[model samples]
Target: MGYGFAWHPVLLNSLLLLAAALLFNRLAGRRYPHSQPAAPAPTPSERVGVSRADLHAALAERGEVVDISEDDLEDILQRAEERSHQRRFGALRCADFMVSEVLSVSAAASSDKALALLRDHRFDALPVTSSDGRLLGEISLRELLAAAGMHPAPLVGQLMDTCPHTSRPDDPIERLIHPFADRGVAHSMVVDGEGRLLGLVAQGDLIAALFREQLERPA
Candidate 1:
């Protein structure tokens, strides 16, 4: 009887210990849950051996692409920007920026007179006009020199550029972009409706005007 009684107490003690262990395990599991497994690393083919289609797909992930390549799209954007600049320039008139105090020469002026006038004003070219102030042509230092080489006392009209580029006061400054900006035409004659000289628009003047306008723009 005594041995059976002692075995009962020991067995009861063992059962209590087992129960406490089970409760502790349940509490521990609730306190710190197991972490999720990490994502698998990309394979060699995905990492290094990407195909051309895959390259395009990656680039197009943030945008759509139709028939144009990336370079073609960039070119189209650049041309659009250029057109926008031209439009902005078109808003300004030629008379507003042309040099009003234009130094000109008579069509019958001598080379010595032309040279003196150019040296006095430090001008690249001078508009050659008729006595009635009509636009005749333009004479530059180059023309004067060429004429002087041919004759000792050369006339201004002989070597002048008869087909000089001319513009109207009301015309947009954008008109100069082609002649001055693209074709490298340095000087232009601003004439009135009656072909009378009003002013002169030179490349330097246009550039200065554009720079001033840019500086005065709102930040």
Candidate 2:
């Protein structure tokens, strides 16, 4: 006698459900195919403050890896930032950072007095002004030393720098950078149109001001 195979009702229903689920998945995939996730937004340099890690990541993305240490790269970036700030604020005027109410010596003051003032105040140089507040020149430790061996101690007017570099209040601070660097000038007299000393600008003052501006810069 031949036997007939019969499927159980539960088993038959489970097979049908499995086939339907496979079919539905295939059709749904065709209709709404999966896509690569959207590329992440680029990291902004200003927002992240341009760290060495960010630079390395950027270089890796561009396939332009360079053989340099992270410390050296960071130093280079810092110098570039300083130069950028210098160029941006080059137009800043001398008056902006100059020290007002400057301490000055009288032109008629003796060299000894000027030297004493410089030593007492720990100043590198002092402006020499006339009785009427007109800038005559400047006196520095160099001049005072030179005048020391003279037969009669010279007056500040005689020993002072008669043709010192001077800057107008409105002059750009950039105008002084090269001169200060090239000539090793420590200070510049900020004078009015009539050559009356208004204030003084020093290398340190410029540096401090630039640093402050950098710190306060907008992100």
* Alpha carbon lDDT of each predicted model: 0.75, 0.78
**Alpha-carbon TM-score of each model against the true structure:** 0.58, 0.58
* Best by the lDDT measure: 2
Global CA lDDT of candidate 1, please?
0.75
TM-score of 1: 0.58
Q: List the candidate 1 regions with Cα displacement exceeding 4 Å.
A: 1-83, 86-90, 149-152
Backbone clash pairs in model 1 (N, Cα, C under 3 Å; residues 3+ apart or in different chains), count: 0
For candidate 1, list the clashing residue pairs, or say none.
none
**lDDT digits (tens) for residues 75-173 of candidate 2:** 687567646646775557889999998989998888888888889999888999987788998888987977776767788988788888899988877
Q: How far is candidate 2 from the true structure (C-alpha RMSD, Å)?
A: 23.6
What's the true lDDT of residue 158 in model 2? Answer: 81
